[model samples]
Target: MGTYRYRVQTSGFGLFLGIAAEATRLTNPPTMNVPVSNRVWLDASEVNNAFHGNRLALNEREVAWLRVGLDKVSGDIERIETSPYILISVRALEIFEVDYAEEALAPAIAGWATREFTLTPRLCNVSRDSDTGQFTFDWNE
Candidate 1:
């Protein structure tokens, strides 16, 4: 065919321990197998936490400096506010190579191969496949 659109995966935006589940892990792992189009998700986190952990290590001198200036920060868990996630359905052209004469108008993987999605903290959840028993499939953008 020319091009096709599939409901790769549907995720529910939620949070886990202040961290969106999808933030830690997306239904479709960010890789070639999993295309950016497959990044379908919905903002379902009304009470989402979306917490992230950051580190600021300090040496003895640094600690002493911070102590001197009262710039020391120590705590158990830090709370970070992140954006919500939305459920989205993705469809891409499955690249089919025929010959130099003919080419399909599907998801193309030519010069542009690698891609990235700037996902804030948001719990994205997609149920595993029941028939094939797959959490999700792989795609590329």
Candidate 2:
């Protein structure tokens, strides 16, 4: 199916990086607490049309991270062409990046005072010693 893109802009803090992923539902229901102070959920068709019916320009790493979001919505990989997606907007200082080591299962994004979600893993990093800190996300892992 299509995917969801999250972009938030705050005063004095231009805009955080936008994240998107292929929309997939989970087979098992997992507990998720994504607060929506001001949020919007879009359908897969809408996402497709916006990107010329092609996959979004999300990088492999971003896509991998987004899978965490998808898993948060559901544990099993089904197809949900309906509601129950995630979107949020907070101050610029709210966004945080997490470095992962071994044993880190699903992907997740957590902010101060925000609810948490369990991200399911579908991608793995092979390396991270590059100057750009670019690591290859292996979907086969």
Candidate 3:
């Protein structure tokens, strides 16, 4: 199996992100709404492959369980295959330095959003951090 990468999006300002991949899809039937001029709420769907050229963040064991698009994930480890796994959070402006943090759980370029997906064949931080602001991601287990 081949693990793919993706980011979660939300309507922080106006229209959020949508996934439109070949096999990826929304979880269920969606409802239409016009909150203010044009608005929606809690709308979750795997629209298209917006991150087709993105990178993977997984290990050999995990990569063995990866597929192209959305596949169910069953574990949570920080780094794999020398690459780091990230656990993205609520804030949109935060970023994990490539070579600093052990793994980076960063939000997509679209900005603030909430999503659930895993990236395999992780990316390694190929830098040497010598500054104070630089932080490293670590896994206790």
Give me the candidate number with maximum lDDT.
Answer: 2
| Candidate 3 residue lDDT tens string, 1-141 | 112233322232111222221211223322441111111112122122223533333343322212211112212222121222222111111222222121222212111221233334333222224565442322111
Model 2, position 121: C-alpha lDDT score: 33
Candidate 2 local lDDT, 28-55, one digit each (tens): 3323423211122212222222323443
| Candidate 1 per-residue C-alpha lDDT over 1-141 given as tens digits, one digit per residue, 9 for 90 to 100 | 022121222253211111111222343333322122223222212312112232323234422321221111110001121222212111222211222101111111110111112212222223454576433312210
**What are the Cα lDDT values of the candidates?**
0.21, 0.30, 0.23
User: Positional deviation of 104 in candidate 3, in angstroms?
Assistant: 4.2
Clashing pairs in 2: 26-74, 26-76, 27-76, 28-76, 106-119
Candidates 1 and 2 compared: the better one by lDDT is 2
Instruction: Order the numbered candidates by TM-score, best leading.
Output: 2, 3, 1
- TM-score comparison, 1 vs 3, better candidate: 3
**Which scores greater on lDDT, model 2 or model 3?**
2
TM per prediction: 0.16, 0.25, 0.17
